[model samples]
Target: MSLLASGSLLAQGSESKEKEMEAAWQAAQSSAQAGPATVKLGEQATLKLPAKEVFIPQPAAGKLMHAMGNLDDERLLGLVLPTGDDDWMVVAKYEPSGYIRDDEAKDWNVDDLFKSLKEGTEAANEEREKRGISGLEIVGWVERPHYEAASHRLVWSMSAREKGQPADAPQSVNYNTYALGREGYVSLNLITARDQVDANKPVVRTLLSNLDFTEGKAYADFNASTDKVAEYGLAALIGGVAAKKLGLLAILAAFFAKFAKVIALAVAGIGYSATKWFRRKPSGSAEPK
Candidate 1:
């Protein structure tokens, strides 16, 4: 072969090899970053690197703002939130399934769970109205199942607006809800104002792009350790046993001391009701013999 032709062929071969290597590298990085797909509620999928990472249900609003600063990427999913002026945006990463598989216990159907959530939303709206506030306006809701060879994961999402004045009409708010192990995690994001697109769009995009289907590491960082019902029940049982052995007043006093605020509120409410009842009755009226 001629010298020129040989050189050209060698260059082409080198370029092809380079391209293949790059593609392989990208695949490896993606796999490494997205560890496993299955996680229970309250579990988190963390990134390999520790650079400026923020967990869902991040500690402070200011921290979230800082983590999202100056990020510009468009391929990410934008979760919009409601604001008085314009909608705010947040990006989501994980899609979870809602199916629960328990052979001994009753299994919850995905469709039924969704129906229950819808009912809850309606009830929330009614409660708002009772508080003399405008009702909630929901934009959309998303539910998807994450599947693996052996099991499935459930995820839920909803977007809605809270009460606002007529002049300050409701805007959008995006909610991303999912279960990791047995714990639930929710990520919220606010949409940007119309005029502030330049400042907010890039942040929204970057957040979405960084989000993927890999197992999330953020869940471990923030969930409460014990289940409230189980913990409280155990405490009550122990206390009851001790009270039976000792004296009821000591046990009752301990309980009241532990839940002073709750008891105080209940007492106050009862006192107010009694006072109203007594005031409504006629002072001169005899007992209904």
Candidate 2:
């Protein structure tokens, strides 16, 4: 989600705005695919969605993202939300920017990555404030960037708080994971309250593992002679490089300044409907929630 005018919600009138949100949520919930299902991520990959979660496909997912202040991005595949109250949501995106080289991960410096993240976020804050959203500052990494060469996967976590908020104030965390593919990569970013990340880590990791590229789309299947290479390397996904290329918020999407309140609305509107959706399923259905 990019930076949106914080007042955008209020401008629509509280009651009217909420009705729109509820309507969008309802539309999305009605289309959700109950899990223990196979969901194609465009043409690049597929996710083996577990029984404890639900997959909301595009159009509906895109609508929900818009209702929440994000622009309609074609890169968005869908949304992964838990079957129960997990207090987190995953935004899945696929960037077909060609093959990305992971060689930089070997010698990348952690301190430098941290420094670049702080600087990039500080710069992004100026834009956030201009749009009426609270300025955010990185509190430092909750979990440093870790890359798995064999699996071609990357994982990292960071916490942020609204500028001027007290040190003890509740913060938000963006726990990101990427799975590389021949065509490009797929990212699954989990947005949640900072305090809940540790408890929620397993859930996101499971989903990441469940996602697999199709036969010819696997990273190792890249054809050097014919394939295009991404301009940036793996490390770029972390800091300045990504901020410059993809925009900081595009990479982070950490719009959790008011996540608790936003999630409450999500649970009330989407989660409750999802529960009822499962109940509506026939007992003889092949996929049970």
Candidate 3:
């Protein structure tokens, strides 16, 4: 083929991919539920999402994540994006791994936890390299793991960058927050650039507070006689448990440049009205209006 024809075809292919990505973004926004709404978050919990933000519930959410280069996760309940200048995202997932004991949280030493995470991430890098994803190194904790016994909540943050990356290279942060439930835990991870994490931390915390497990699903309702317990404890959730998950969360930064335009347009004053889905709620909670 002529060089001119080959170049033209390559350009067309790139344009086609961009169009497809933009289409996915628009579809997700069209279906997104604007906040100040009560919506079901999987079978065990509800989200009282606030206004000026939108929640892209599943199926559509899963497609958008795939387009954004994230691996498929059945546990993904939905995604939250803002309608303002906060260029960040919150990924919400529900894991029915059974009750995760939090007793270990009290005994966890920050230094020990950091060591475990560093080692675990180094191991996870092997898998990333095998898949052709850039190897990442933990830059250190943005926020040390903190657990609230009374609320059954946990919060932590970490930053990572490509191995051998210059010290001045941009870092990606994952500000993770979790709400423990009788069946398992619900996690809301805020994905943003390192420089933006401090400003967006409160945003994710607000969403965490808005998540409520249905009656009988609260952590306090665990029936020790009949309920199943997770094999790992809270400490594992921070150390080994987070290593694989962090790899995926970290990769999100690499693809932001590709989809930034579409995302910016969606969040730029677009009206994302609320939409209801088939929610499974226990008897005590009020039905979606």
lDDT of each: 0.30, 0.76, 0.72
Better of 1 and 2 by lDDT: 2
Full candidate order by lDDT, most accurate first: 2, 3, 1
lDDT of 2 by residue, 50-114 (tens): 88788888888887777665567888899887767566788888989789999989998988888
lDDT of 3 by residue, 1-289 (tens): 9999999987786666555555556567567787789879988999888887888888888877665545677888998877665678888888887999998887878887787677666666675666656677888899988999999999988887778999997777778899999999998888877887898899999989888999999999999999999866786667554444444433233222222222233222222221211122324544322
Error of 3 at 113 (Å): 1.4
Worst 10 residues of 1 by lDDT: 255-264
lDDT assessment of candidate 3: 0.72
List TM-score per model, in order.
0.29, 0.84, 0.80
Error of 3 at 66 (Å): 0.6
Candidate 1 at residue 241, lDDT?
A: 29
What tens digits encode model 1's per-residue C-alpha lDDT throughout 43-68? 33322212222222222222222222
Which regions of candidate 1 are displaced past 4 Å?
1-59, 62-111, 126-133, 137-153, 159-179, 182-289
Which 10 residues in a row give candidate 3 its minimum summed lDDT?
271-280
What CA RMSD would you report for each candidate?
29.5, 5.9, 8.0
